[model samples]
Target: MSQLQVSASPHIHNGSSTPTIMRDVVIALVPAIIASGIIFGPRALLLIAVTVAACVISEYLSRKILKRSNSIRDLTAVITGILLALNLPVSLPLWMAALGGVIAIVIVKQFFGGIGQNFVNPAIAARIILLMSFASQMSDWVVPFEYSQRIDVTTTATYLSGAESSLPSLIDMFLGVRSGSLGETCGLALLLGGAYLIFRKVISPLIPTVFIGTVALLSFLLGGNPLYHVLAGGLLLGAIFMATDYTTSPVTRNGKIIFAVGCGVITVAIRFFAALPEGVSYAILLMNILVPLIENLTIPKTFGREVKQREN
Candidate 1:
């Protein structure tokens, strides 16, 4: 038999490690983090701190127990913490957020084979788990400080629906006004973060661009303004943060477009027809399960194979 060379892929490394990418994600999330803290008060920082600390600790302990070489230096735990914090309501108790972090890092992430091997997006899974476990606490939303000092908080469904009577101004919505989860409130910040990710080459534009466009087009056709749909709820957050998860998302360009479109369609369907107000999280999670199928269908054509076909 003729000798053939076979080895691992990704032969080219940009001098970037898993931890570097994770760290970039953390840096990208900062604008939103600061905006959230300003809008939601000091508790936002406290919640973020606890969640990050808990995730790191849980990851360390899990790796220790499993006797695996510790990879906590990868900053994945920090990313998970920030992501979990972004999905949480501003009023959630500190302990609950920490619990979510633990589930995200220890259970969903490490237990499933660490960063690249996890079957689902850990932060989204943790968010869903928290919602299931603490429905009331998870649904709590406080009005922005602009409204009052009393923090007249209310428990409502997620933000995809019009459950909240007082809609934030378009300007405020773009500026991270209104009230909801920490990173979720600021559409502008998410955009900035998304742009940063794009600039850093951490994520491709296909997923987020397609995801956002699908939702915008669909919503516009159904009588909603495109800009309004884009600015509302966690569309920005989920499209950029949750949908573009490296491990769970498609690797092929065509597959990414399909994944993004599927996310937008599911999100709109859930928002328009379903009882649940927010669908981005669920939509992304649903698409996460379809990545393999999408990649299979959208596999890139071999360059020389087409030449052979033409000759034939």
Candidate 2:
């Protein structure tokens, strides 16, 4: 007689793997990458190309020097490169952008034992490093298609250009016709990319939906425009991409909700009360540091298990 095999209940397994999900993420990022290039001109494209090449090359050399298995094929380095580029200004020096890529893929990402083992979001970590290293360069943004004999330092394009005004036009913001980060300006493009991710089932809506909804609701209550809130800065990018990092974010549904809500609260607080204009990066980075605690606090109840009360 043959013994029946017992499984851990997920019994259903598929051909889906880490590489598959990373590919889907890359596809989702294409629309925004192209939009940024079209809007910001060659500089944007140049930054993307340079950052990506730097990341891939850095990863290759780092692995070779360390005698580790080749990791550039996993596409994590590509995603990190793209994301880091999106977080940067078009006016940054190519060398600095390349440095950001090195920090992203090598220091923050690989030094800690590659993708899934990293404690923080690599792009955000690299961004923070760059921001701290070169504050002026990081803040310098140029208008879309602004190529001239003499470069100007004027702030020509910014979503928060007129904070004194009651509100900015939501339509303009959503249509990617505003001034901001290269890829973050186009709310519509980000949403389309996010929708693609959702359709591909690479990410759970629990995090993005709950996170964005919390920000929207709070901003509305604070007399801010809800749609504009969704369209501004890196909100969409953070909600859809950064907050959903498999290594740094929560795994279970409840943990995801809490982590996202925490992101929303911190983001709103920073936007409204803090000195910085936008808070998505800091918020996600902060929450990335909290994933373990969130997981411990919100683990799913097993079948026929009693709920444990919080000890206060």
Candidate 3:
């Protein structure tokens, strides 16, 4: 007779590996990358390259020093690098961008036991850190394509900065003609990337739908322009990508709904009442921290486990 063997949970196989899933995510992000390059020029691509190189090298060095198996091949570091870059302003200094990458990989990711064990999304955390540490550079928004033209005015303010008198048209906002972060400017590209992820089964539409719906409804109720609120900041980017991180988001359907709703509510509250112009990153980070408790409350009970009484 053949010997019996035992293994961990997840006995079933889905035939999807970490590298394959990360590859799909990278593919989905390509449209956003292209849009950012067009809107912000070649400097945008150079920033991405610098940040990615920083993240990859940091991961390699950290793993070597820690005596752990190398995980750079899994491509989580690459995704982290790209997401971090997307959240940053195009005019941000390259050294600062590289510093954010190191913080994402070495501190937030590997420090917490690497990929699956991270408490929050590394890219989001690093972006927040950079925003706090280098407020001026992080908030500096340069006019798109200004490097090519001899324009007297090169700096511009984001739509969310209470510049209603100079707001861009909805068409321009959707087509990446606005002043904002590298990736968050283009609603069209983000939606395309999000759709690809949903179609490829790389992510579920549940979190994004609930999060955006909640924000839009609240914004309408509060006498704000719902469409503008949805498109002005990082709401779409966070809802579709960062908020849906597998390790940081809830596992059960009900838990996901609760998590997303919480994120939306907090985001709207901050945007409406708080001093900050944007709230998506903080909302997602707070919700990521609560995922464990949400999962505990929402996880389904095993079959037949609650029906029997034991005798001592």
Leading candidate by lDDT: 3
Show where candidate 1 strays beyond 4 Å.
Answer: 1-11, 146-166, 305-312
lDDT assessment of candidate 2: 0.84
Give me candidate 3's TM-score against the actual structure. Answer: 0.93
lDDT of 1 at 199: 98
The candidate that achieves the highest TM-score relative to the unseen native structure: 3
Q: lDDT tens digits, residues 1-312, model 3?
A: 999999998999899999999998899889999999998999899999999999999999999999999999999999999999999988889999999999999999999899899999999999999988998788877677674542222223245544567788878888878778899989999999999999989999999999999999998898877888888889889998899898999989999999999999999998888877589999999999999999999999888666667888
Give residue 90's lDDT in candidate 1 (0 to 100). 71
- lDDT for each candidate structure: 0.84, 0.84, 0.89
Q: What is candidate 1's CA lDDT for residue 104?
A: 92
> Residue-wise lDDT of candidate 1 within 1-312, one digit each (tens)?
999978898867779888889889998999999988888888888889989999999999999999989888989888988888988977788889999999998889888888798878999999999988998788777777652343544433334454335555678778877767888888878889999999999999889999999999998787766776787768899999889998999998888989999999998888788877578889999999989899999998777664434564
Model 3 global lDDT (CA atoms, 0 to 1): 0.89
C-alpha-based local distance difference test score of model 1: 0.84
lDDT, candidate 2, at 52 = 90
Candidate 1 minimal-lDDT segment of 10 residues: 155-164
TM-score preference between candidates 1 and 2, better one? 2
Error of 1 at 54 (Å): 1.2
Error of 2 at 55 (Å): 1.3
**What are the per-model numbers of colliding residue pairs?**
0, 0, 0
